[model samples]
Structure formats: structure tokens, C-alpha cells
Target: MTEYARGLSHEPPLKPERPQFSSGPTVKFPGWSLDKLKTESLGRSHRSAVGKARLKYAIDLTKELLGIPDDYLVGIMPASDTGALEAAMWTMLDPARPATVAAWESFGNVWIQDAVKQLKLPNLQTLSADYGEIPDLSTIPQRNDVVFTWNGTTSGAMIPDTDWLEPGREGITINDATSAIFAMEMDWAKLDATTFSWQKVMGSEAQHGMLILSPKAVERIESYDPPWPLPKLFRMKKGDKLNRGIFEGATINTPSLLATEDYIAALEWAKSIGGRKALFERANTNADLVKNWIEAKPWLRNMVSDPAKRTNTGVCMVFQGDWYESLSDEDKAAVPKKIVKLLEERNVGYDFNGYRDAPPSLRIWCGGTVEAEDIERLLPWIEWAYETVKNG
Candidate 1:
């Protein structure tokens, strides 16, 4: 019997549309209930006392949820994780010291482009691996700064631990942990700087970036003299001094209070649900559901070659068999397309299609908002979709 037939079944009076498990802008929690968003209040002046209090409350709640260190500064910056990362990079890098970057995906490559190709930093170096693997950390240059993505969302690959980092390095480590924050464990003691957005596991609206800097990052910002002028948004340190106001609710510009409140609400929800343990359990449960399904079906397997390196949040898998390889280019492409279409037609999932840059692989979201039972129910629908498409 299918798991969906038992307690895993959806509640009666189903919506014409089913739940969503796409990469971003995902479905609300299965039992999440909230009042209408307070968008009207967002247009008012953010400099007002009430606005300031709300912003501060949001920041405080976020810090509590993430268990951030007391010395660290968690500030709201412009854009998403991209802006936060760029701000750190542009403001904190010291041209005098060598810089090393680990390029694993699209976002990592962008920073390397800036440090090496665009900025023309003479000491720039990159240790890159293919889509599914991480380059050897020992290969990174010593006595120089380093950059890496904790979770490569595009490739469904992740570095499971940070133990490889050398202690007492002369330079800093800037990490773009956009998808890894909250979804995975991050050791602040081992990292100098990190950036993330609320859109992923937090399930908040996009556009705002949360940049966290350690005391070491602060010291670098205050002492190092970069070869470029720092933009107001990216200004963490200036003239041998750290900008204290940026950490105290003085964002580069006014942000939507509605979004800020939503972020706070989400963080609060995270706390209420047992914090990191709850979040990690959800990912583990979801991944196990999909993995069990894959093991039962010989025709499909995860695209990530190593099971240990597989991402718990963004799960990617591909079809197997000579039947798949025997087909023409268009025919092979059509297999995943047909599977996606059938699933959509049944309203079981959306945006399960593989990334355009990658081979034919199904990308599913198993983030914080997703419940274990929902994932269990969704697996059968995948099998049904594949069969429906193959038979048709």
C-alpha cells in the first residue's frame, strides 16, 4: 500500500492546488497560521521610533534563534546574500595579502571573477572542483584570505564539516553560506565572516541580506586598507575604524518593516519548533524519505556521487538505465520533461525540473517548512509520475 493511503494522507477538502516544494518562494508551513501581513505599515518612515524598535526586535530574535555569539554583529544589508557577500568582499579585503577562493558553483565563481579577473589582484588563487566535489583544503594558500560556499545549492553538494580549516591563519575566511545557514551547522569560531538571506530555510521574502562578522572580521575591517572605495552599503570599516552604527540598526537604506516583521516571526517559529535540532531533523527525515524511494527503485539515483556529500536541503537525482542512455538527446531530455509534466498535472509538486545548467535531475526542496510526512507522501507521487510518463 502507498504511504499516502495511511495517516500521511492530506487533510480533507484539499486545495485545487497541492503543496509546493520548489527551491525558493516555497509553500507556507503545513500548519502555519498567521494574520495578514502588515504591509501598509512598511511604507511609513522607517526612522521612526516604532520602526527602529521593530527592527531591533527582529535582529534580537534572529540572533537568539541562530545562537549567534555575543561579539558578532548580525546586520541587515542590501540585496540578498549576494549583496551581503559583495559588501564583505569589497569592504574587507586587503590587497597586500594573498587571497584564495574555492569555486564550486555559480556564486563562488562570481567572487573569483571579481578577485582575479576583474579586480586584478596579483596574489589571487582559486582551488576549484567539479560540480559535485570540493577541492582539497590543503591546496588553499597559507597566510592569505579564503572564500567558499558552505552549501552549493545548484549542484546539491555541500561540505559537511569545517574541521579542514587551519587554525591561526594570518588572513580571513569569507564564506557565502546562503543556503547552509540554519539548514546546516556553522561553527562561528572557525569562520571570520558569513552571509545569508531569509528566503531559504527561513521562508521569508527575498531582497534583504543578513551579514554576520566575527571579531576577527571586525579587526580586519578596522585595520586593513583595501585598494578600493567602499560603498555606503558595503561600508563595514572606514579609515582604520569599524562602523558601529551599521550593526545598531543603521542599514544602508530603509527596509520594508513588513519583511522585517516576517523575518522575526519566522525566526520565532524556528525557536518554538525546537530550533536547530528540529530543523535538522526535518531535513534528515525528508532526505531519508527520498533516499529510501530511490533505493527501492533501481531506475533512479542521486546525481551527487557521494551519499555523504549529498545535500539535505536541495536533493537532486537523475534517471538510470540503458533505456535512458539509449534514447536520442531530445528523447533523454523528454523523460524528465514528461515526468515534470505528469507531476504538475496531478498537482503533487512544482518546479521539480532539473536546473538548466545541470544534467536531467529532479531538484526538490526539503527545507525547514517541509514536514516529514509530506515528504513521505510526495515520494509515491514521484513514482506515479515516472510510470505515468514512461507508459504514456
Candidate 2:
């Protein structure tokens, strides 16, 4: 830090074109504007002909954008990712079967709590790790129900691949893929129930979650009666059979037509840019910009020790070096607090601070909606802020 911190100009770096880097509800797609969203569906009952069609269109576009299997089901749920995941949990997971729930970050921890306390699964095996590290999930039982997150948004760590999943596995696998859907590879075959919200990789409006189910998951729901009572929002079954209307576009409750329009625009944007492949490339390109910047400097480092396990979206970082570590714990905490505050005050960055429960650090969104050039521009601002705060 001392070596590169010297002889630098006091002037601040050029501002990024868009300073939004929030992990969820991230920056919108380039060229996105209010006028661009469709207004025909606004103010209408979501159950009306026009509103239902609009909602279904978003679901169809999602399947097309991600190349989801035709046999699978995709539906819009309320309360964003949390609701979608919980719906799958309450309906699909059976109390009779032993299960494995794995988590390595804050949201993952939420699921662990759901299984242990909320669901009260007596035979659950909980796997977890501290922030910035991934728990080894390589040996989960093939016959044990499993729940895991594809990417830990708070930890900046991701499961690198699906090699751990077996093709002949009997138990269904539920995945929380909010941050990984567009930016990371999703091995659909290994995943039984997958959930995400438009607010993540697509950078659309929030509060609407997408719940996708594989054939195996649907079968489980049909045969298994929920041991616990489900709320109106979590009920996917209409009496004895699965409610197919939800998957076909009739939501349990009203959805924000405005957010639906914004999400549709995002999916359309994704198609124009070469679909899923292009989205992953853009996110990786932005992550690379940050990765290179971190390598070139001595003062900062990626929070994840293994580069392979880090997520392209929500890349987290922490300050390093003897001079910084030598400071008191309170001072270390203040460093990122001050750096983020300075950057935010200058409008050079926004919502890029690390998760509160984790160590004091930085978390930058490198999702497809964010441009690589903006990341390159923002790197210098981070360094400048770090120095400014540490020195003062």
C-alpha cells in the first residue's frame, strides 16, 4: 500500500457513468429508461386478460433467455427470492426423509435456519463456513434432500460446478440462484427446484421472484402432503392437485405490473445481446476488471481466498498489508466505512459496501447490467478513497 500510495495526485478519479453496484436490484440494463417500459398492463387487475398475458410473457421470456427445459415449470412469486425459495422448501421437503442443508454466507444461513428451526427437520445435516470461504459440499448423500445457494452474494463465493451432484441422486436439490442465474453456469439437470428474482443479474425492479421446478420436484409435490401448514402465498397446490395456473401466469396475489414491464425489457435486452452466453461474458469481463486491479495493488485483496469460487456478481474485497492490520480493530472497521462513505459522498460509487454481518470491506456488483468500462473507471476511486480515509 505504501509503495503505490506515494506520489499519487490528490485529485479524485473520474466518476463512473453509473454508480449503482448493489448486489440485488442492481444497475439497470444499458439504455434502460422509464419510457421504455410498457404501460398497457399498469393499473389493471393482474388476473385480467391483458395483465395475465403480460405476466406469462415474462415467464416465457425467462425460459427462453436461460434455455430452461420445456418440461420444467416457471412461475412468479411474491416477496422476491426469499418467498420463492421458502415456497419450494415448505412444499417439496418432506419431514420423513433425512436432508442436508448447506450454507456459506448470510442468505445461506437463512436457509439453514429454515431447515433447523422453521421446518424443524430432525435429521437435517447443516453445513456452513465463515464469510469469504466455501463449505465442502462434495459428499452430500445422494438420497438426502439438499438445499444450497448457487452463489453466496454476501460472501462473494460460489459453487464452482455441479460435479458434486450425482445424476442418480434420489433426493431433490433446491437451489437459491438469485445472483448466479445470468452470470454463472446453472446445471439444470442437477437442480430440482431453482429460484431467483429479476432484481439480481437482470437488474430489474424487485419484490417478484421466479420459482422453477424440474419434473422430479413436481412429482415430489404431487405425492407428498405438506406436513406443515402453508400460508396463502406459499400454497402451490389447489386441493389435491398442483395449481398449474400459477406456473402458467396466474399469480396467487397481485404483482406489480411496472416491475413486470421492467423485467420484460431486461429479458428482451438479454436476447438482443446474444442471450445467456453474452450475459455471463459481460459479468466476467467486469469481474476481471476488478480482479486485475486487485492484483496490481498491494493494499487490497479479494475476500474469497480461492479465485475459482468467487462470484462474478457481488465481488467482495478487504484491505490487507501490515500497516492496515497493525491498526486497532475499531480502526480497521472504520477504514471501509470511511472509504465507502467518501466514495458515496462524491457520487463515484453507490451500494458497493460489503454486507453488514461480514467483515468491514467492499462488495462491488459485476453483474451483466454493469459495464466493464464503469468498473475500470471506479477502481481508481476506490484506491483514492482508501488512502484518503486511512490517512485522515
Candidate number of the best lDDT: 2
Query: Per-residue lDDT for 32-69 in model 2, tens only?
Result: 99998999999999999999999999999999988899
CA displacement after TM-score superposition, residue 178 of candidate 1 (Å) = 1.3
- Taking all chains together, each candidate's TM-score versus the true structure is 0.90, 0.97
For model 1, the superposed segments whose C-alpha errors exceed 4 Å read 1-18, 33-41
User: Relative to the unseen true structure, what is the Cα RMSD of model 1?
Assistant: 3.7
Question: For each candidate, what is the lDDT?
Answer: 0.76, 0.90
C-alpha positional error of residue 70 in candidate 1 after TM-score superposition, expressed in Å: 0.8
Query: Residues 1-392, candidate 1, lDDT per residue (tens digit)?
Result: 23332322322223223357776655565455557344545766777777777777777777777788999988888898888998888877767778988877667888888888656678878888777777787777557898889988777888877777777777789999887777788888878889988787777878888888899998888877767766677776645688676677767787878778777777777788898778888887887787777778777887778887888888878888766777788887788778777667667678878777767778888887787766766777776666555545
Residue pairs of candidate 1 with colliding backbone atoms: none
Candidate with best TM-score: 2
Candidate 2 global TM-score: 0.97
lDDT of 1: 0.76
